[model samples]
Target: MIPLAWYLIFSAALFCIGLFGALARKNAVAILMGVELMLNAVNVNLIAFWHYYAQMRSTPYVHGLAFTTMVFVVAAAEVAVGLALVISAYRRRQTPVVDELTLLKG
Candidate 1:
């Protein structure tokens, strides 16, 4: 049986990688992908905790699984909205690069 600490460490590493991607990427779509990665990392952590600690015989933590499911739903919605916005921006500016979107001048 893999240790809980290992799962947590992996999740933390994934979260940090996602954070770096979100911060370093210039394309809006790439940033959105990074955000998704981060969300997935959180989900992994939640599930791991639920499995290791919440399933105790005394005080079950099944509630954490529910919260994790909600987070997944929210993450899906966020991806939908974010992708829509990226498409809209690309249509308006003809480029997906974040640095080239300075066209607010009328």
Candidate 2:
């Protein structure tokens, strides 16, 4: 049987990789992918905790799965909105590189 610590370690590694990608990447789409990776890592942790802790009690937590599902839905919405913003920015500037988007002089 796989250990819970291994799962947690993998999730943490994935989150860290995503964070690094988001911070280091210049392209807007690459950053978006990194954000999605981070979200997926969080989702994996949530589901793992739900599966291991929430289901162990005699009276299981019925709402754990529901909460995780809601989180996934919210993540999906966030990705959609973020990608739409990136697309709009690309259309306006013809460049999807984050470092080149310094034209917002207000």
Which 10-residue span in candidate 1 carries the lowest summed lDDT? 54-63
Candidate 2 wrongly placed segments (more than 4 Å): none
Per residue, candidate 2 scores C-alpha lDDT tens digits across 5-92 of: 8889999999999999999999988998888889888878887887788557777785657877887898789889989988888888
TM-score of each: 0.89, 0.88
User: Which lDDT tens digits does candidate 1 get at residues 19-93?
Assistant: 999999999999998999999999999899888775465778577789799999999999999899889889998
Q: Which candidate is the best by TM-score?
A: 1
lDDT of each: 0.89, 0.84
